[model samples]
Target: MNRLTLVHLTFLSVGKPPAAVEFSPGLTVIYGASDTGKSYIEESVDYMLGASELKSIPEDEGYSSILLGLRVDDGRTLTLCRALGSDTIEVFSGDLRDVPTQPAEATLKYRHHPKSKSNISRYLLNVMGIDGRRILQNSRGDVVPLNFRDLARLAIVNDTRMADKRSPVLGSWMPQNETKEKSVFKLLLSGQEEPVRPTAPSNLQKQVGKGKIDLIDQLLDETRERLSVEANQTQLRDQLGRLQATLANATAAAGQVAAERSAVVRRRRELEAADADTQQRASEVQQLLSRFDLLRQQYESDLARLQMVGEAGTILGYFQTGTCVFCGAEPQHQHPGHRLGESTQLAAAVAAETRKTTELHHDLISMIEDLESQAASLHEDHARHTEQLEGNDQELQTLDQRLEPLNTDTAELLETRSRLERELALHAQIDQLEDLKASLSAAPPAPPVAKADGIPAADIADFEQVMSQTLEAWQVPGDNRVTYDPTTAELAVDGRPRKSRGRGMRSVIHAAFAVSLARRNQARGFIHPGFVVLDSPVLTYRRPEDNKEEDELLAYDVVKNFYSDLLDNSAGQVIVIENGTPPKSVRDRAAVYAFSVDGSTRQGFFPPLDSSW
Candidate 1:
């Protein structure tokens, strides 16, 4: 099996100095304090291979490109350079540590594409003699092109994943990819790839059945999500019934109150109209009385003037008999008959006018009395109307006050009913979805195909033996009887699952798994990446702050044992990233890089901003 080894990783920029780190072919240990870019080294290596993106850290600012050096099994050195935020990789023929000044031998895409071979994944897989491999992705015997990322996860374990509860064979924690991850593991174990199977002619009925199944699965997922957050259906229905009854009673009471309010409002409006009319009539009557009083005064003045005129006529006829006052003649020239006749006629006319004037004045007084009577009657009517209007207003106000609580109750009940109805609707929808899913599940399933599945039992037993030997060599504190469970893809020690152990134990077990897998591959001549980068593999051995229970379990000198075992027995390049220092003897044997924060030693993968290096 051909294996490509990592030579170095470098970060370059335009004006800023390059940050770089070289790796040993056998064992390289980078142990440092926190926040000194120890984990970043592992991340950059993975990114250079096929990871989607590189994490952005403040310390990585001003760096525009990353260079990864690789040495093939044939002693041919190559460098892969990729710009920041770009998806293309530039492949150089030689091990140029810094950014390449000349053009690259080949340019490849960062991502793996099945139809195209000009990608970094295919290029690296070809170099390792494992290109064009296929793995079963699902139980339906569906196969997908085996991607480099599948193998990268097995080789590159980060700090966060070092102590994961899941089995190390299952790289991603996603449950949906269990089959595919298991297939990848089986591939690493057996060195066998799933062959391509031909598709049968499509049947209309089968197509429809499959489509229905797919839709039902989607609906089931959605329904489950909804039901996860909803209350009990029976309880919701009961609450809805109660709300409906309460709303009915509230609505009836509100209707009665509304009717009573409407009646009072109508009466108030009628009273208002009548009051207005009465006021208008009273005003008219008062004006009539005033005019009538003025007419009565004129009538009295006329009567007095008429009486005075009659008296003056009588005086002129008696005292001025010598002269004819009527014609302005002397008494001797005037005719006696003319004077006496004129005086008598004048007195008669005055007496008649006086009688007429007196009668008119009495009539006028009677009219004035009638008008005053009418005015008084209108004033009384207006007062009565005003009182009635006030009474109606008070009644309307009382009706409104009575209706307030009823209206409030009705509104609240309606809102509750609306909420209950919405819940009931959701319940109905869920019920429908469940029924549909059940019906779809009742459909006939596709016939199963017989193909190689799971790691062979003999192969598993061999791997388990190797796992036990590795743990014993490291002197892990336990009676280690390692057994691999294919069903769960987990390893167990003395009938106890690895996940049930502490974080420290889990980390150690995870490291043992990776190291053992590599060694097994090398020993049996299986295909592998020939390198493993573990971040914080011995976490609990040094960092007791993670868990006190882990500290208690890992009380032995496991760190020294761990480094010593890897130095002596590791099959390929093993890069260990940790927090604290390893044993001095082990450190002396391995290529060790120490990082610090107080300018004591090497700062990190990226040099300090103030440093002249």
Candidate 2:
């Protein structure tokens, strides 16, 4: 940031307001004894420059406005004003000799209201191009400094917590919170802050930063007390529910089994009744077969006798059988012409007997056929009955197999129902246990707000740039290294950033931060409104003279280098409202624009010390 040279300003004015205070690019001081409107002037600048808050004035100072005669980077002259009530402020670009007034292209307002106190480090932020946390107050007078400062450690305010000093919490580094913000700031400036920070996970997030457990035993005790009864109940309940559902399925299956069993029993009884009919058919078929076999033997005998008679007739016809033609007398049964003798008669009788026997054989054959036909019909009926019996037996076997499982299933179903009921009971018990446990246990606590994105931490980019440039201003060794720790959120040198809690250490750190920023402005031009109107920084000195000399020297070098750097830098203006002398080098190089408290104007007005435009 460029060192400021105040040219003109008026807070409580009568005629037209001192609408402009053209600032110089070099050293500018608005020094005063107690309250010569020095702080008010700073507040005026802040009001015009978009401070979230501003000081309220009495009704006498209507529509507070500031006007300035300014020099451009191109060596041109212009007039600028900040009008509180006007729709737009006026701007003149040319020479003071022939000024032309026109409305400014843009109208900027303070981020804070025009009734709040401004912090010193905030001015530094504005100069380095940072927006310090502008706390908004509530009706109850509670301040919620811009929510961006969740972590207080990130806010480095005064000389008490300089960046160069070793931090106490971190023996070899700065704080983690600050470094994180710094990294973010750097990224934001570079347009890369959006990509950082972990993405939210898909799984249920385990509540972080909850349930206090200061000691290991306390944690164990809490877990044990909370989970013991609930765990057991939950398990039992789950088991019971499962068993009940299983049992329901089993009962349904068993009912189907019982229906099948009834069908099997009815079929078995029918098969037993058909057995007697099958036996009767078998006995009739056997008697007919026996008679047929005896008839077949008798038929064979008759056939043999018929054959013998036929042979005898043929012989008798050929031989004249009147007398004993082969000793044949009258045939035994014939008496004609030597008639058929006893032999012929006996042959006739034998033929008749044979015929009868042949008839009997045929009858036997007919009887056998009838018996066979009857047997076949009965066998068919028996076969049908046997088939029915086999079917019934098979069904019975199947039923027997299913019956056992069916009964078992029915029993299981009952058990399952009981189990389900038990499970429900257990579940209820578990729920009660959980409630009791929760009631007995303390509620989880919220985490402390982390200090990040505020002036101190957010200033990391400015802080680092300033410090690095400061060292460069001092021109330290080429190997002088620097790194920022994200975890501890501190800037580490040679790879370590320690948190400083000691008085000297903190002072040095703060001093380093201021010098670094001041030196950076001295070396490079970066316009930021966070830094401006740094009237005085609040300090907390822990010791009489701890690291005081080192801090002073660091301060001097930084201020001197900043002045030297401002010759070309145009980032923004820094108005250091100081009570002591500045370094010699700073005095020799830059123009001094001061606000003498005992001026003709009681409130002290702006005018160049050398009276040069």
Candidate 3:
């Protein structure tokens, strides 16, 4: 089994001699008065082992760096030096003071990360025979890589930690950490190491998947709404075919309507042209009738003039022998102005003029009759054309009314078909996404591993036995049938819960738990750091407040035997920092360091706090 033992812890000052605490393989104790920096020793050890930051103390003011010396199982010494207020630690081959100008190996970081070679957890965990091990981090059964800081909670116990009621394996009070903490303890007990494989999907991937599912669901809902019906792909395809056939029939019908509309348009245009021609012909016929009437009137006027002249000649010829009636004179003796021409010549002239007038009148009458007949024929033709134009106009109006509804219906059908096709396409996309989601959900799960659920029952039983034996050796009060509760990752003393006991008993039990773990690992070849630093483990014995007399006596006896039992824990290193001194039996067999208020003999872990300030 690989083991890591802390040889010494040294704190170096800027311009003064360094203060150091030494340790041995079996047991080392630093017991002294209060405020003597005993608790600081445990804190410093934890800080060097990758703690986030060291606690501030007045005695630590002048310290420039902290150095921790470790002896690996190979018996080689390695020293790590951390400068004050720095995140990097320098590693040396042997003991260190201040900071090394040139480190023997690469500098290590104070934090842990998977890809970092300088991380302190890797360096410390490697020496402890537990490297590349994983621990469950969350309920998803996802495992995070192992590091020494995770195990530090079990290996280092400060004053508060000793009084804490929670399990030593647990680092915080968060409930999420309960399972993981128990698993870590189980891993230490089992001593099996396994490299972590990051099989769990990343947070981004999970989030994206959820987003995709949501989007697909939303799209599916919208598509169904657009379709106004819920149907499978096959049903949708059938519907599409039906719609296509309907559209095809509708289109053919619309084409016939369009042809009828074109014919109506052409007929209407022809009627308009014919109506215009009819109007022009009617106007020409009316003009011809007006002109003929005027010529007939002129011929009637001429005939009247000729008839008057013929009458005057006839009267003159008849009244040749008679006296004039109006002038009382004979016609032969009348004035030349009033006298008519020779009777014979005048009569002939009148007869000829009358004949000419009569002939002209007849000719005019005949021409007028002919013109009237022609006008009548033209009028008949105009009337017929006018009637035909009106009928054509009525037909055109009717056709326009019929085509309007068909055009509207065709447009509506086309739009509806287009919209349905688009909705079908959207449905196809939604179906694809649903299928993908199903396949992903059916994916095989990761194989079950130890610690994925919790620690094994048999391993817990073995751990409980070791703890019970340790407490029995210490002669602890109450039943020695102690058991490590895997659920709480703590111990149950005499069937009672560990935290239910008093602070005095709790401190003793917590100490026993740490010591037992180190011993158990050393004996069983389990993975451990081979060292445990416990601060004020026996504080309850020295200062038992409000405790019964029997309980107080029990505490005293427990503290005495506790040290003796620890001395026998071979192959394990135990460092106990306390305010109370130990029993002589254990003191004689261990290395003991004492700190006092007086500066003459010992100045505590550092120079005098007053001098340092």
Candidate 4:
């Protein structure tokens, strides 16, 4: 089987300054302090392999792009460059310097896409001598094209996962992915791919129908909670009809009351307008009467004064004095300036004033009488209008009293009608759900069977034996014999659960399990990517947990013997990332890189701050 191996991983700054590390074919160890880039090495390798996103770190500040060089077993070199936060990787035929402006081949998609030829997973899988392969995802026999990322968990183990208790075969913590994950692992172990068979259109239609049935079932359950009555569509419709008829009757009765109230209100408005006009007329009549009374008094006073003048003139005429009584002269003796004719002139003037005053007195009396009559008529009209308004107000109060009960009844009817309509709608929904359910039942697709027939029993036994031997070689205490539990997809050591052990023991066992699988693949001619990267595999030595004295010895023995075993067997390539110091025996055999924070040799994975991007 063709296999791929990492040659180098480079982080290029904007100026193309490089922070890179080279790897050998066999065991490679990167041991360093807490904040060093030991774990980042594992992450970068994954990112280059097609991880969705790169972890942002302070050490990554200067890096604008990542370049990974890979060498195939056939001696061909491939370099892939991906800019930060980008999903497209430029592929080159050979390793080159300074980010290439154009790739030699078409760009590869970072994530797998349906029906895409340029996805990185397909590219990498093709290079690994596997193509056109499909894995059974579910048992209605749905198969999906193999994806590299699903297999990456087995190839690369990160630090936090070192403490996880779930089976390493499980990709995510979600329950739904467990079956697919186990299936993929089994396929890798058995070296067989399920045949691709296209589903018929009828089968697809059945599946879609089933999905709709499920959705309608869920909707019916929700609608059931809101239904006021438990009844079928027929019964509910009958009840709706009755309620609607009742509502119509109630509406008509209420409308009649409303019309009557409206008529009463309109009549009240008309009476109010008439009363206003009558009041205005009464005001004008009162003003006219007041003026007429004043004129009548003036006319009477003038008439009285004129009558006195008339009497004085009559007396003067009866006396008939030819000359002024004081002068005592005859008519001939009266001078032009004398008052002999003054009395006659005064009588005449008085007579003319009296005649004019008498006429005015009669006219004023007549006008005053007419004004008094008009004022009386206005008073009568005002009284009549006031009575009419009072009657209208009483009628309005009666209408209001009648409408109050009608409004309450109508409100209750409307609320009942609305509730009945809602129930009717729910009935319609239930009917729809029933119809969908029946349709689905009539043309049901095969149910998805549980994925139980996992890896072959003989293959599992061989895997168990390999795991047991690997752990025994690592000097892990207790019965090192392991068994793979198909149900849990986890390993059982010494008849005890792997997760039941201490965290440190779990980490050690997890690493052994990973390395053993890779070794077994190479030995048994199984399909594998030919490389595994483990971060913090031997954490027991770093932390004094789970029997310190015993763990220290085991950790030392495992670290010392682990590398020797891999190198001695020419096992698949492995990268072990750890914080604990490496054993002298292992250090001598493995390519080692030690990192620190004090600006010593190999300060960190990043370039100097001033030289960074």
Candidate 5:
């Protein structure tokens, strides 16, 4: 097996100092604080190995080109140089650490092409003696030409991927990539590729299938045309649920408002009735007061007349035997039995009439007083009724104000629910039509391929043994009973799934998996890149807050043991990018680069800018 090892990586730009880092043939440790471009080194290496793009950072601003140095097992030192933002890599003959001054080497496209050997993927694979390989992409025996990226994903474990809950063999959680990823893993383990065998349906079957497919296509188009909404079925359902809840709330609120309005209206009616009755009573009291006043006035008038008569009789002196006061003649000339003798009787009658009229006047005054009191009471009642009515009117106005918006909200929610339901229905129809089309178009099932086609069960057991030994060597806190599940391509420790562990444990387990795979491949003489780059494999273990009892045990000396074990056992280059510092002894044994942010030591991969340079 031919393996390629990384030598160094360099960055160059005009009028700037070249930023570079060299790797050891054994273990290399890059450790430092965050934001110091430690992980950028890993990214740059992956970028040189045909990653889609290199992340842009502030430290990488002035750099215009990236250079990667690789030493083949056959003593050939090849340097790959790529310009910034360019999709092609320029390959040179020697281990050129600096920008090339001459240009007489092959240039290769970054992407892989099936018919072209000049691309970078094919070029690298050719160097590894694994070129022109094919692997099964699915159970149908459909094969795709092997690319270097399939191996690179396993070899280079970035910070974000190190703690991923997904299996290390899988690149992502995307369902479409599962079969291909599994096949790639099989290829790495067995060193044999699955041959391509194309399968086709019979003509008669194709004819029947085509007719059904055409009808399904038309139905699908119509269904899709009706699916005018932008949201998918799940989103539509979620929206409908939320809209229903909101509509229910709005309806309840509207009911409450209506109830409140009814109460206010009823109260207003009661207040109005009370106010009318009060007004009527007040009017009646006023009329009685007027009549009593008239009666009192008449009584006063009769009393005054009676008093005048008494005074007139007294002035005439008819009762005192005075001479002829009434007829302007002597009293002796008046007959004793004449009407003039009745003057005394007339005075007595006048006095008695005056007393009765005065009493009647007193009674009338009392009646007027009672009427005035009733009028005052009725006025108070009217005032209270008017105040209550005003209050009810204000409340009704407020409820009406609230009901307007509630009604509007309810209408909007209903409209939204209707729209969402329509979208959901359309989605279901499209799904059903697609399912029917699939059933009609599906070909006869291919002969069942052996589940363990490439990597056998014994190989999985061997791999699991390697992982258990690695964890045990690192003194990881577990029984170290490692098991590899081929179905999920995941490892379990002590009967617990790798994904069930905390982020810190997952990171450690993932690193152990990568290291174990590389070690196993090297031991078995399998085709591998001969080098692995791991970013932040021990980052979570450094944080005390994330530490558990198991993590605390892992943190004690796991970092030192991790570095020491790799240094002692790694057959090819193993680059570790982390934030936690290794032990002094391990640092002394391995090639260590430290990045600092406060100018204490080397600042970062990119050196400090000097105007003198």
Candidate 6:
């Protein structure tokens, strides 16, 4: 187990002398004569721990405040200080002074003032170790806002007042079980009360049962719907069969129609081919006739021109003086030779023209004759083409007539089948719906179970076992005086009768309980805030002050045994501030640390010097 030394401590009441001091392990005793500020040392520890309200010092006492310096086991130092004017508690490290809260450097450096941040509280109460704060709170009051659940989980605690306070053994577990009444004490500090559960009988289960039956019904209905679908399957197949039969008949009729149409088309095509041939011949004959007409017209014009021009013989015989067309006989020198030459030439030209014209006439006559014969043949072909075209037209009309009824029948049959299929599908769906309705009418029920308790058995063992070891270390022996009661939720202790037990016995029992609680704290083995600060206990020295030997010795024994218990718990600190420091016989066997408050101050007022302002 590790220990924490009070590096420094200072006490100040408002407008009074402040006290400053330091601490070490084993024992730290502040020896202050009458009017000395010895109690300031104890008060300083309290202020640092969590005594929130300011304690005022008298006018003569310099300052009314407190300051403390703690050196933790891991070498981290913390400074806790409070002054008269300060509205808040402050902490720091080294030269860094007047800190808002504990420094968060390390676990060793953790120094919590009364008004610490919530996270720091959680760290202390939930994570650091077992929490003493909640248990402390049970004895204390509403000092801060915190999570009590987390606090209780961290540690359990006992204070110097344990001996004076009543035991928690009776009715402690009453609040623990879900069985009975809850306790206010448990609620305030720990937020842990009696477990609770609904007392009402459930009606929702019946509704759920009915709902499940309905769901099953729905499922059955769906199955019946499936069966309906199966039933319709045969009808649909039969309808399909009928449709197939109708389709087969229609297909046969259509096939016959197609065959007849094909035959008609073939005959029509043959007729069309004949018509085309006749039309082509007629066109050729018409073209020949047109050419013959042009050629005859040219020949007639050429013959007319030939008739207008007389021959050379007519010119010689009918010369009659004008004469000499060959040579202007009378008016000019008429050359008979020239005339004869001209006549001969003219005669030859006339004969040539006459021959060409005669050949053209013969060609025209032959063409006209050929045109007449071809026209006669073309007229016959045209008559045949007209007859064939009329026949093809009638055949095409007949084919159209033959296929129309088959197309209509196919359309009507297909439409009727589609309608029947839609009706069957609707009927099948309705049948399924009816089955679903039946299943909803009949439902079933369910079974029951129980809940278990969940308090951790491991924690109970640790809390109980650790306290036992701590008690033994404190040298406080007993015959199974204390026992844990989960039902009542406390550790019950049976003490010897007050008069018969004597002061020694009572002190031993309570001191054992306190030490046990301190040791049981996991944080005490590692990091701790401070020593266990006990209030004044003077039950042993109740005899006359004048009886120096027996009374003095007995009083000495009380503090001596108390101090011895503290020394045994050397892993941490313990402060038992009692009235009247004890004498030699009890002191010889133990170690003691002494501190002096040199300042002159009155009782109930802060001291001057030896502390701080």
Best by lDDT: 5
Give a tens-digit lDDT track for model 1, residues 166-224: 99988777776887888888888888888666432247756786688788778767756
Q: Which portions of model 6 miss their true places by more than 4 Å?
A: 1-5, 12-16, 29-44, 50-64, 83-87, 95-160, 164-481, 493-508, 520-530, 537-559, 568-571, 583-605, 608-613
TM-scores for the candidates: 0.59, 0.35, 0.61, 0.58, 0.59, 0.41
Error of 6 at 48 (Å): 2.9
- Residues 106-173 of candidate 6: C-alpha lDDT, one tens digit per residue: 33212343454432333333333333332212111112223422222111222233333333222122
lDDT value, residue 571 of candidate 1? 68
In model 6, state the lDDT of residue 79: 62
Q: Write the per-residue lDDT of candidate 5 for residues 1-613, one digit (tens) a residue.
A: 5799999999998889889999998999987667778889999998998887987988888899999999998888899999877999999989897889878378998898879988899999998888977777665556888899889999999999999999998998887678788888888887778766654445686788888899889988988888767887778888788888888889998999889899889888888988998999899889888888888888888888888887787665544565565555565676765444556777888888888888888888888888898898999888888888888888888999989998888888888788788888888888998988888767556456533235787888888899899998888887999987777887799999998998888998999988998999999998788998999887643341321223333475777778878988874679999776666787678889977622236877888766346
Number of the top TM-score candidate: 3
Q: Given candidate 5, what's the lDDT at residue 512?
A: 92
Q: Can you tell me which runs of candidate 5 are displaced by over 4 Å? A: 198-445, 449-454, 541-554, 597-600
Model 2, span 207-254: residue lDDT tens: 321222223335445545544233365565766677667766776677
Write the number of the candidate with greater TM-score, choosing between 4 and 6.
Answer: 4
lDDT of candidate 6 at residue 329, scale 0 to 100: 64
Clashes of 4: 0
Candidate 3 local lDDT, 501-526, one digit each (tens)? 87767888888888888887778778
Each model's C-alpha lDDT? 0.81, 0.46, 0.73, 0.77, 0.82, 0.49
TM-score head-to-head 1 vs 4, winner? 1
The 10-residue segment with the lowest total lDDT in model 5: 544-553
Cα miss at 397, model 6 (Å)? 20
Q: Could you tell me the lDDT of residue 511 within candidate 3? A: 84
